[model samples]
Target chain A: MTETEQRAGTRPIRVLIGKPGLDGHDRGAKIVARALRDAGMEVIYTGLHQTPEEIVEAALQEDVDVVGLSILSGAHLTLVPAVIDLLQAQNMGDVVVVVGGIIPEEDAEELKKLGVKAVFGPGTETDEIVRFTRASVGRA
Target chain B: MSLGQEILRGDRRALARALTLVESDPHAADDIIAEVYPHTGHGIVVGVTGAPGVGKSTLVDRLAGQFLARGRKVGILAVDPSSPFTGGALLGDRVRMEGRGSDVFMRSLATRGHLGGLARATPRAIQLLQAFGKDLILLETVGAGQSEVDIMGFADTTIVVVVPGLGDDVQAFKAGILEIGDIFVVNKSDRPGADQTMRELRQMLHLGPQRTWLPPVLSAQAQQEIGVAEIADAILRHSEVRLTDPEQRQRRMQEAERLVRDALADQLVRGVVSRSQADGRWNEVLAEVAERRLDPAGAARALHLEQD
Candidate 1:
């Protein structure tokens, strides 16, 4: 482990997990949250029905290492871009932002180009999420 | 000036500064973490999740106190709900944890409409705390809804809190809360139906396949502080069990990978679109799509294909 990992051995990786827009299907989001927690990262999950502004503001206030967005309503194009824009407008381009839930491969590429660090579709192994986040946050 | 560096050096003041930067300037926070990337990964992250009205805040308060008493510096990241109308946070967790604020490093973050019971800046804040020499970090989510359960992904040990008298076995199971718990906590144990809840949880646990690690369901009265010590112990125990399992570690790494990939995609896609929009390409394409001159897929393809 690196020095950061050594230090983090005593502290947890903090992440802000959110579900943006009106997507009511949160089962996958919740499962991922639990999986991340089980893997030793601190998670702050924003409840459902959040606007883009609220998501950005929460990210600002929480000071999280990573931001995970879960959406299953096929609104990834509109909502995801809006969130990325809000974060960038707020000068938060570096906080790792990821999205999950029912995203198609095509949309995933679009989201990736929009500065989403990662996109996990359904059946994404929980362990994959933990690994990517740990690495992204430099814990790995 | 780099919060990540300051955190690595265990500077409390610097850690605070870093958290502030993360909360306001996430881009800057990223630079900070990049600088200090080599010095993280040594903390125990605990997540406390449960249904609403289960006194989760109170339980967190007591648990933090316990860690403080043990001489471990604690970092508490409490995720609060945002106001629907104002887009601001009510942030009630801070008020609930008023007394412990001075002792432990405590910060309450409003979810601010981020779904899944998570706040956006929470990860950066935890890094700051780790850099500040906090040995243990406690992340208390809003409540045990599906969104709240999703937030559990951030914890090394997850304690799913429930209350007695909520409902019968069917109701409890219907909530689907059973599947997410690593350690089941029946808070409000002093209530009349506490034992019944505990028994039901235990029965459910046994009915499941015999895994290497079987989650334990314990009772607690967060208001009275009853079983708080046991709850803490259970969390620690779960952590130990998790640590020993190589499969668990692998699973965690994989999950982290998914999170990172998804985040990267989100960031990159947004960047490309924004840059294109700034150059008037986005609007032009949208207009073309709207006028039936080009298909949406074709427009998207042209936009990205041109970049490559």
Candidate 2:
């Protein structure tokens, strides 16, 4: 494993990178997934146009330490909260939720209020996201 | 309720948690599994294995749908390889599978440095699924090449998937997959060389020793959902035959023997290694071996397994 992918006891940190809602653009999500994998994390990339229910179900099934939602379709206000609520309703509030893709400062703040751990807008370096992911999850 | 109780009550989240525990904390997992062991042995595990790009995942997805339609609760465990260098893995098998509704639980596993085309925790995960009361469990192994036959020990029905145009009839024999498969699927059979591939596979099967149930070489275009039902039927027939067939009983005995041996081996090594480390003998012996003052076998002998 890479130096960054330290295990809490055993098994690498598992992350679910999901694209919720009608966001067709997935380049950012793919790049972040690749960066996480290179850092020795197991990344489960749920391909594009996933519903919030689908994303949360995947999180529950995967038991991922983190859920990174990428939304470029300006539906973060709707899709992000839906995912957060489903996770929380399932007693998965400890699963760190992060938002990426085209989210504005104000909306990002609003999402953080809704329990998103962090937000990365466009042009945020994948390394920054990777470091933040490593820091946010208990496994790391 | 206890974790095992929750799992037996049909809680999906608890099943997920127990599966994670299987990978991260074996001691705790052992306790939970002991509680639920009696609830298991009901799930039929089907192992789908093939070389890379041979449509194993899609075929599994299709077969799961078939079983689900037949009113069976389905679970899927798809394994991909981890990077030997970094230990990281990008698990993409789920992408190939369309959503199979909520009752069909799917999990992606990375073979974290384990060999034989599966993760070390796979059997444990399968047990968790079984305890959660899934009627069918489909195991998709890492794109297996030659000699990754460990699936035979874990699967009730082993389906060896292949595509056309790879090689002649001898290819399957060379890979040693010919012997382990209970049923063979020539997936993506819409391609030009599908007929020749199926013919070659049948020819090879006939050349081998006969059994109570001859492994059927079937055809399928898993992507389009064509011919998948036939393969599913074949799987069901094999599962039925596996119950009373003397040959299958012998195979099951062999599998149980291997599982026992593997568990004993793991426990012995872990016990001795941990004791040696606590007494500082492990590091000393390793250092000696590294410096070539003591050979590797001699170092192992120094551990004195008989006394430990």
Candidate 3:
């Protein structure tokens, strides 16, 4: 078990799970969202087909602890950086940003350089994600 | 140290807790801000925005690691989209950073349905981080659309990331993302067509008259960690230049003034509406408006008159 699991008690981390763009495959996104929720964090799953504006607006109002994006349409190249830029423009540079699904290793590195905290690829265990989140938020 | 004092002294843990309180119960925001306000304005804020799939998150992760290597304490705000189905957020940004969460300085926020591409609690969150003594703060939003551009008003510097084969030029033009980018990054440089995309971007940038700050176009293979250092250097340079610009300071102050006024107006309107509802006056006004006995504007005017 990770240190986070050992330290996990209460104080669930709140995460905002989003699906941006016209991507229609939401099965993975929803499953991950549920997994995060079951892991004890408050998960807000923004339904499929969200515009960038809608996603940002939701992040602001919900006051989420993190922004998790799941995109499978290969739009990560266009969408992920845009989200990061928008947050920075809004003076929200302190929020942890991560992405999951179908991201290539090369693209993942690009995103990290752009200021994303982490990127999860296919077959990553939901528990590992939960543990990472707990550790990131310092709850562990 | 007391929580308030710790926050003022730039304690990361304290800042995180304070932010949690503000989000869960905004009634405490004023108190927390009052305590930490004096310690802010010492950090550089960088905004990274672009359309979906532009590899923004990986860039951020790499940049944070770069800054960490430089011994600078960093704070990141990764904004996620709100769930339309449930009005909540899934908050998954921390997954990328993995073990870095041990740093005790990073946080994430969901949009929670706030408009203009900014998390409503984002400013407060940044202030909390600033108070925590973070030398640099980065905000990564969900996408680079128009609302994202509007939110750029809050940052000291804004970096826009675009990837090759994404038709970024056309999208940037359409979304006005190009206008707001202080620096443009062509991520995924190893991909075919990256050179053409960069060349086209350079030409597009040069098409306009040169401004005081020339936006540089840099290429990065983020997955390979190539050019990450150059990107960080560019951000620092821009921040340094912005700090020295009097006009930039003036613009920030102006923006702050507008935000303050807007917040006050929203609060006042909300207060009056809620109070009227408790006093049964809101229902009466609504009835009148619904029955066409009085226009909604007229009813609102009457409420304002009563307050006066």
Candidate 4:
């Protein structure tokens, strides 16, 4: 049997990497996707300029355990809430949403209060992201 | 209502959830299909494929839009490859398509770790769409490759897109794509060498084979809406060709063969893995092979892997 036909040896955790709004910056998303994969997670990346609806649809279709949003467009406050609302509408509010990118330190706490599991800002290492996903997804 | 009933009743949200079940969990998908199978087989399915950077997404966007213009509900199943190494994938084809609408149901799928998933989950997704009342389905796959070829087996008509300037011709395509394409489209035909590319395709068609159905070489500038109507006409014309009884039988046989092969392979792996703990030596045998102490073929024989 091909590697794909057989399930992964461990049912590797699945993560959806999303870019919301018109930001168009995917360098961080791609890097985080690579990092998460290196940590043995199956990552589904929805390419840049995705709407909140598209991101939520992808998360549902992929059956991802975590939804990681990369927002550098200063639109996180709007974009993140949109995703959260849709995920809840889809009965997936508990799907562990995480955010990464340029965020004001003050907005980070607001995001967490809005149910973002965690946030990674500038100068954050991929390893830290990987560790966070492992522990968070593993528990969630 | 049950998922199957919802799907048969043309519930869009139910159909989406059913497709998700199929893409992620084969066991659950099987149950859903068992209930909905009889209601499927209504939609005309088309496979659109080509190398990346060929504007395939744009062409399909136009193709599906035209079908919508004709009032047919369209379901687009776009497959993007996942990195075999990290199991990470970027599925973005739908980004270029005209945004969602009431009559259109579009889903972008990542290959998830299945060898031929481009073909496997696709038929099931198509069936859900068919059951959900889509009159036409477009199965879009990533560029030319073995998986793309394997995935073509599920379609009623296959449209292979080739752009002019990226540099490859009929001879290059002849390696394999020429045989499978029901319609060869020169997308981005507004670019230089559009006519030259079309002529090369025609000349190559003349030399390829003698058959009742001659796959047409058409030009399309999808972004500008140039020649899309002709390309659509060719696709519709090709799909209209009736299959001879013998040809019909052959097609069914091929589909059955592939289905059986995939099922058997899946079952074989499941059985062996499930029985390994009871067998006691499964890991030891694997270790022996991994260490090269026993060849894989010999180890398999020892395990009676082929006795069935």
Off by over 4 Å in 3: A1-32, A35-41, A44-140, B144-146, B287-294
lDDT digits (tens) for residues A1-140 of candidate 1: 22322332233566777778787877887788777766655566666777776666666655567888999888889998998898888677888999998888888998999889999988889999989998998863
lDDT of 1: 0.73
Score every model by TM-score: 0.64, 0.95, 0.69, 0.84
Please tell me which predicted candidate would have the highest lDDT against the true structure: 2
What's the DockQ for every one of the candidates? 0.03, 0.59, 0.08, 0.27
Least well predicted 10-residue stretch by lDDT in candidate 3 chain B: B95-104
Cα RMSD of predicted structure 2: 2.3
Residue-level lDDT tens digits of model 3 in B83-130: 544444555554454235334255667665566667777777887788
Position B4, candidate 4: lDDT: 89
In model 2 chain B, the worst 10-residue window by lDDT is B167-176
Which pairs clash in the backbone of model 4? A4-B113, B50-B143
Q: Which has the greatest TM-score?
A: 2
The DockQ for candidate 1, computed on C-alphas, is 0.03
lDDT of 1 at B134: 77
Interface RMSD of each: 14.1, 2.7, 12.3, 4.3
Q: Scored by CA lDDT, what does every candidate get?
A: 0.73, 0.86, 0.75, 0.78
List the per-model TM-score of the A chain.
Answer: 0.90, 0.92, 0.88, 0.92
